[model samples]
Target: MLAIDGSFLDFKQLDLLALRQTPVHRLDPRAKVLTTLCFIICVVSFDRYQISAMLPFLIYPAVLMAVGDLPFGYIMRKIVIVIPFALMIGLFNPIFDRQVLMQIGSLDIWGGWISCISILIRAILTASAAIILVAITGFPAICEALEKLKMPQTFAVQLLFLYRYIFVLTDEGVRTARARQLRTFGKRGLGIRHFGSLVGHLLLRTWERAERIHMAMLARGFAGEIHSTRRQSHFGRTELLFMGGWISLFILLRLYNAPQLLGGLFTGTMP
Candidate 1:
């Protein structure tokens, strides 16, 4: 029960963070969304063996987190949770491709190893950017931004509903688990046989609760779109600068390997 509650709180921390009054949080959501999309594209566009080139993209998320007043440790923890999935994606790289790509001192690194490490770096960069985006902009605003950017209304509404009901589903599951625990002490109701029944009950309860909520919303005159109490923001000059600056930086990083150029300059290796 405690674990369920703790996980729920942790999951909702991004929404809590989004309520802050920082400059990053105040930018038009469209700007942040587009900038983040550009960042992800640049980071993932690198060749499979390119690692150092992608390191420069980390600055984007770092700046956002600092300016947005987001908790670094909390965001890092969230990113760590997704790292295992990234690892799984790249796990077989080294086994399939064994050609040597680089040599450092006595050790030779294979192309597959480099590609695998590149995937890990890409995962960290992209994941951090995404989490920071949600922490500052919130999911609702993001969905709204998508709608404004010409996404289908149905698709955006579906995304918004999916995000909103995740909490509802989680709450239902937590309550069901607690009730089961109270009814059966220790390992009595914890068997695999009881698991299916618990899930069935939770699903039925959630379905009923959803129906009631839907009826209430309909009665309240909820249209196809959900509206926010917050004042609507426009795409102003500040948003333009914010989006343009980051996109320009991303383009620069994509075209030139900043780290390699700096190393060359320091070592007098530039022609």
Candidate 2:
């Protein structure tokens, strides 16, 4: 049998992790979703140069990963894929803002470098939190949780379909590419002369596949909204405690220069 594609394998791994019986996976999805939203907010709210303030926010994702039994390397690799996008957007900071912010021995730390690193740190923290949330709560449960929290129905429905269509799209792309490869006998595949026709055929094929899926859903009485067989979960005491604890921690981290404070306490040096 052909080995599954690596990208699809990672996707399946996350979905499978959500199906595990860990406590984090079993939390009311609404709670997990809201907490993750808060975590992202706290991390993103830091100043463009406030790298020190961002360090404490790492605790939230770390806890979730540990509690959810998530693989550190797998999640970090997913996070690595996002770093270049952040760098692409923020890389000019050092060139534009070159004021020295600090000195260590013979080295000078530029404010722009600090700010650029800050952006990268914040990106990793926020992205990892999101990945951990999906790993624990899964996509469908998150949609249901959002609906329960009164997210606009249209937006929620669109989100659900968008997430589901990704797999469909990837599958179609891989199969199309594989067929092209087979026909070309590994010498050349889908040359520029044939690119336009292949592009059209790929779209047409994916559309037909989606149409058949829609018809199948209709035959099975799929309503305008996606429904789940999972029982409705409530934000009870456990969820309330979970949300409260994290929010409090996030608030504290947001309001304090945690790194300086802790570093001073430990080493008698203050920034």
Candidate 3:
């Protein structure tokens, strides 16, 4: 499927991006994963009506994007597609809770609209942080980082295998499509009648391909665990500093309102 190709290409691009030797990329994947998890939790913990407070949270992703050399345009585009889903989480607040909060100029501002905007802001902040993390760390390293963090072995192995075989599955599907296309000979072949048989064949092929992969892994002594040779599990001074600094910042941001403080800087109203 064309969609399959597109999905594979997007992942390939992110994987290539992760191979760069930037400082952010060189840091322990645990640092990034832990920081990102904390960031997401903090951002989501904000109330449904706290938008401006979430602004300062953008610093995490912005700095990571710069340090990791990730493409801002790519991240923004992804957030755009995901925005509608996030918006829906609070989009109906205005209709159900129409009690007017205040009057903005000639318009009555509803609490629902404010809450909706807040959810969207939180969504953007959290989504951008995740995208930046994956672009910098790649899925493989993240899995390794999770394993090191004592995540369940079964979950990590499942993730690694899915990533490993998705390519093979896609390739086989593409070949199947090409063969069908060639046999069709400029005719309308893949009609509803052929759909069942076509899907069944693809399923059979996928099973066979999966069995082959299982055998290969067994031959290579997979031993039911996905081993990553790329990252050594170690806690050095730099990693400690990196973790402590960002975590402290997250705690501080959670305790204080950075956005309001910045906003009141020139008005002599800062606390």
Candidate 4:
């Protein structure tokens, strides 16, 4: 018999917050994780002018945030922050299209505007789902879910370490900022002398701390792997039901046109 080699795979990182736990947190990270993937796939599959058909899709995020008991205002705030990026990219569509797709009273709307709306909606749906997924499930759980779904362990470990140290480094940054403030009583904050020393010192301190942390981990028996044998999240009937309901809704929206009152009227189709 020929022997198979397992040495070709490379190491990968884990996302720390993906492994967190809450009400929405504990319900099968795999399901929550996969649902987000499905959401993206569905949103991106829509035609550029597929606006009204996509409105029903909002129910997915709404139900998720509500049932998952996520922070409503916080999720909305995150959406706001990311919207500008989509708008900046999508705004150009109107200037090019100028083709009047529809007429409403005195104003005529171009297909470009409609397409822009579709792109923006797709962006919001994709970004919001991602944010909510992270907000509810956290990063570590996501990595764990990925691993459980057959992702490489090395990558998962990297994601874990990256997230673990990001906060640590951020705290270090705060301290460094405080020290800089103490020295900048009269000088401009970003003057040449102050800026050079600040950059130099922060880099030195970060490297020193990283080395120390690595040593500490090695001392505590952190071998080549960042191993944790925690129980993986289980998928039960509830999770199956949750995933199925949304999936069915997605398929239904994909196959037939959405109802008029649900925003389909805006697109002039209600099949």
Best by lDDT: 1
Ranking by TM-score: 1, 2, 3, 4
Collision pairs in model 1? none
Candidate 1: give its CA RMSD in angstroms.
2.6
Q: Candidate 3: minimum summed lDDT over ten consecutive residues — where?
A: 226-235
- Report the poorest 10 consecutive residues by lDDT, candidate 4: 1-10
Candidate 1 segments exceeding 4 Å error: 1-4, 177-200, 223-230
**Each prediction's TM-score against the native?**
0.88, 0.87, 0.83, 0.76
lDDT of 4 by residue, 1-271 (tens): 0111111110011123334445666788788888788877887998888888788789888987786666677667668767899999889999999999999998999999999898889888888888878767777777888988899998998888786776566566666766776777856777787768777887898789878988998999988876777665679987998688777878888766666545557776554
Off by over 4 Å in 3: 1-4, 170-205, 228-230, 269-271
How does model 1 score by TM-score? 0.88
Best by TM-score: 1
How well is each residue in 224-252 modelled by candidate 2, as lDDT tens digits? Answer: 76666756676789899999999999999
- Estimate, for each residue in 1-271, the C-alpha lDDT of model 1 and write its tens digit: 8966786779888899999999999999999999999999999899899999999888998899899988889999889888999999999999998999889998989898989999999999999999999999999999889988999878987898789888888887888888888888766775888989988887888789878988998999988667656458789999999999999999999999999999999998973
- Which stretches of candidate 4 lie above 4 Å from their native place? 1-23, 174-205, 260-271
Cα error of candidate 4 at position 124, Å: 2.0
